[model samples]
Target chain A: MRALLVVGGHELRSRLRDGTAPLIALVAPIMLATLFGLALGGDDDPPLKATIGVVDLDGGEFPASVQREALNTDELKGVLTFRQYPDEAAARGAVDGGEAGAALVFPAGFSEGVGAGRGGQVSVMESPESPLAGVVARSMVDRISALVEARTLAVRASLEAGVPADRVQVFVEENGAAGPALSLVGDPVAGGRVDLAVHYGAGMAVMFAFFVVGTTARSLLTERQNGTLDRMRAAPVPLWTALVGKSAVGFGLALVSMCATWLSSVLIFGASWGDPLGVFPLLLAHVFAATAIVMLVASRAKTDAQADGYTLGVAFVFAFLGGSIVPVYNLPEWLRGVSLITPNGWVSAGLSELAGTGAGPSAVLGPIAVVTGIGVVAGALALLGFRKGRFA
Target chain B: MTPALVCEGLVKRYGDKTVVDRVGFHIDEGEAYGLLGPNGAGKTTTISMLVGLLRPDEGSVRVGGIDVDEDPVAAKRLIGYVPQEIALYPELTARENLRYFGRLYGLPRRELTSRIGEVLDLVGLAGRGDDKVDTYSGGMKRRTNIAVALLHRPRLLILDEPTVGVDPQSRVAILDRVEALVGDGMSLLYTSHYMEEVERVCTRVGIIDRGRVVADGTKRELVAELGGTDRVELTLDGDVTAAADKLRVVEGVSEAVVTGSSSIRLLVAGGRHLLPALLAAVGDAGAVTGVEVVEPDLEAAFLHLTGSTLRD
Candidate 1:
């Protein structure tokens, strides 16, 4: 244990003295997180407003009411804006010419058909080039259609019950301006907001945590090349002790980097990580896995350049597949499953759960277990390689 | 007394090639044993096995009477190794490197602190211990390297070409420090291809060639094994043929030959004792302007054993 501590301490001190380690560990993660956060729209920044082109060809109250709801509704205030076109051709032109992301056109007699309790037809024209705004416009149109159908049902029920049609209309009008009769409430999953800063903060942190692999492998190869390994072998310390010591240094650096990124995100960007108890253990497991991976790479490489190349290649592949570069939730279901096979995937899931739902230890336990398993397996392989003199 | 280090039938092979053949040697207590060989003579390989860095395919190494393979940690505690390369963290201060190694050897913090100071002073880097090793000169780095090994105060110090790239002044300083350690009764196994350095620092020498020890003994013993002969050269201003014939009849002269029509070379069993008579004969036959007597050294012994110069 003493030998391990001594060797680990020395390795940490040496790396700390090196300028490149800190640059990769701290600076790069912070920069990437900030860049991604800004690109995704920061919490304090105004949300992007997408323009929806509207063409109410119905020339009636219902179609005009839909347009009015999209234009003057408080919920869609900053989320959407409207450009009224005189005709379907003009609306389609606006969408195709990039004047708006999407265009909503109501066919003639659409409002009369809906008022007579028959289904109305409306066309939503969307540009493939600007999908986000078009998707938002389509959702708004769906809500309006649902409201019109509900009003038709209400009128039909009142007429069947022998209530006066004028009295029913008055009742409908009183509540129609009050918004949707039925509302769906979305509960916070784990009592936390799904902040972009938090998602990107964890992502960039995990991505840069793998950068520690480069530093770790390079240091190992350098020690071998410089004959320090031979020197250490001649010392009283066992080979396993030295290996553990070196691995501990890498693990410690990655852990500190990840924690710093989390803290900085919270302090600098107002990002919340949700529950320290869960986050700390998850970070530990992630760093351990990272360190083991580095050891495995270093053990197989005979030179510094070889180690660097191997580490770089592995880090990039893991980063990409594990959703460090891209969110796994954004990937296809099968791809997300493949991502779960990587340590980074587990880390991403764990961090996302913690940040999104204020998930406690129980929520992150499975991922932590898998990450720790990876560490143990990779560490065993690395030690085997070391004993075989592959590292030398 | 038991030897400080022992290796029996040490054989190390890499696939089909044997890097260190059944080579064996021992360094007794208080003796500085030199392992002399040309480059690629397996000197480093042999020392590596002795220090437990490399395991021999078939052999046994004991340090302070403890088996190195069976109990490497204990064996390593008794040995201080200074590699041919400067095995140090250049970014770390000298004191930091020393303390690190000291702790690796399981030295207590208090003792390690004192030992660091002692080693720094011993290596003449006491005042510059705080400087980063990268900023140090080659000599200083070498000294720090040695200092790290000395931190544990092991029973034996294995220095593998410690002065390979050092300047002459630093070499002298290193040699002086090594001599002092030996004087203080610290056993040493100094490996070098430089014959002069081995002769100057080692009490006994082993000449290795092609992974085998060709000769091993005291410097005098090894030299005496080569028929105890010495060579004398006379640079004459006049005819050297006469000097050659006259020198051939000297009491101790074994063979005399003339070369280049200006000098005569003589081989004698005791060239120093017969130098005066040989000189007189040369002067009588020809005007002897210059005379040089070559005594048998480690180089000559190495040449006699391996049929090649140590440098080659």
Candidate 2:
């Protein structure tokens, strides 16, 4: 253990002095964060604000419940502002006049058809001026619609179980007037509205961290070529000591890259990374997974050039496909699922889920577990590769 | 005293190719032992096994009475190794490299601090130890490489072809430092293809050929086994091949072969006494232009044992 730490500290100092690592690991991500953040309305820009038109021809408890429960949640505090229109034509007029990005209109028989478990429909009007506002409105409406549909199915099941129709009606009225059965405050419209600067900042940190680890992992081949590795192996320490020590430096660089980007984003861009308690595990897990992946890449590579090429290749692939090059919310829905397969994807996703002031603490738990799994499996394979490789 | 290093049959193989065959030797405390061999003769492979950098497939090595396989850390603690290539980190200063390696061998921080200066001074690199290794000359880099190895003050120092590509002056300085180490009671295992270096620095030498130690003994003992024969080189003005044929039939000449365009080399029991017969036997072949008889040395012993010169 002493030897491991000594070797680790030595490698850290040596690489830090080289200056390339500090540039790639420490500075590059901050620059990316600033560039991407400024592109997406920097900290000094006005907070995202859009008005959403709402029309209630049904004038019933269900549409009122959705407006009060989902559309007005604190999660959309700075992004969405709701307006009540007297009817569908008024809402459409407001949307066409650019008073609202989009409007949701509930038909007169909508609640009656929903209670009857029959045909029901709602119409939406969107203006071309604010597509993102339309998206936020659609997401919130879709969530509320799904919640109502589930509740309607439960009513149908109870009615089939020989419950009275009047009692089911009473249940719906009481619950609809009360708090939402599924709260929208946790993940609602603003799920995608996570401060873009913070989201892209986290992604940049994640993507560039691979470069830091690449140098450390590629050192195995470099040292082997230059004969330094053989000299270390010639010492009294175990062969694994060299690998562990170098990897410890890699792990430190990963952590430092993340924290530096996070702190710099906060200080420079005024972006809050949600709660640190929620943020830390994702940082550790994502960094661990990134290190493991680069180690595996380096171990399989036969030469230093091959290792370098593969490291850059993997970094870019993860960055672009995992939503680092573009914000996760901007990626296609299918690509979002694909993004979770990458270490960068999980980090971007989890960090974005916990972005902003009201972020739920538990939002990062899922990504943490998944990224940690990635670390474990990749870490195991990397160990096998190192053992099988010429790391001796 | 138990030998400072002992190996009965250290073997290392890669698939069907055995790099280091059942090689065996022992070095007593403070004795400088040289393993002499040409390139690809398994000197580095053998040294790797001895230093615990490589695992022997079918044999064992004990350093300072500790079995390397059983207690590698302890066995390695007694050994310092210098590779043919300069192995110090290029971006690190010589002192930094020494300090790191010293810490690796478990030297305490205070001891390692002072010991780094001492080792640098010992290698004649004291004032320039602060410079990064990449900024140094080839010879300085080689010196720093040796300095890192000596930081821990191991009981045995194993250097594998240390002076292969160094300048003449630096080679002399390195040899001087190594000779001083030996004089200070440090056990040493030096491997090189240069027979003269082995003869000058080592008390005993092992001649290895094709992964096998053909002979190991003191210089005088190895040459004495040659039966006091002298090596004679005769430059003639006639056909060298004809001259070699004539010299082969001489009574005292054991072997005669054409060495160059007009020169014949002969291994003779008493070269000087047989000189007249050799010249007379060369009557029609050529008049002897220059005749030289040399006393036997490590080169002759190597040629005798391996049937090839060290240059081969």
**Pick by lDDT: which candidate is best?**
2
lDDT of 2 by residue, A1-392 (tens): 99999888878877877886789888899898888888875643323566778898898776777666654556655666779999888888888888887888888977776775563667778765655566667666666577557667767876898878878766755655232343553454453566768877887888888988988977778887889888888899997889889998988997898889989999888788888898888898888999999998988998888999999999999998888887555567798788878988888777766774456768878889999999899989998898767474
> What residue runs in model 2 are displaced by over 4 Å at the alpha carbon?
A42-191, A218-220, A302-305, A332-334, A356-359, A389-392, B90-93, B127-135, B220-296, B304-309
Looking only at chain A, give the TM-score of model 1 against the true structure.
0.70
Q: Name the lDDT value of residue B76 in candidate 2.
A: 90
lDDT string, candidate 1, B97-195, tens digits: 887778788888998888899999999999999998999999999899899888888889999999988888999999999999999999999988677
Each candidate structure's TM-score, on Cα atoms with residue i matched to residue i, is 0.72, 0.76
**lDDT, residue B252, candidate 2:** 83
RMSD of 1: 9.4
Tens-digit per-residue lDDT, A1-392, candidate 1: 87778888777777777776688888888887878777773664322356788887788777666656555654445656778899988988988888887888888887666654465767899876454455556666677667767867866776687867656665555645333332212321111234667767887888777787568778878888988877877788776676677777777778878988888888877877878999999989988888888788888888989988888888888888897876564466588789978899998888767776566878899999999999889988888888776342
Q: What is the Cα-based lDDT of residue B108 in candidate 1?
A: 89
TM-score of 1: 0.72
DockQ category of candidate 2:
medium
Report clash pairs, candidate 2. none
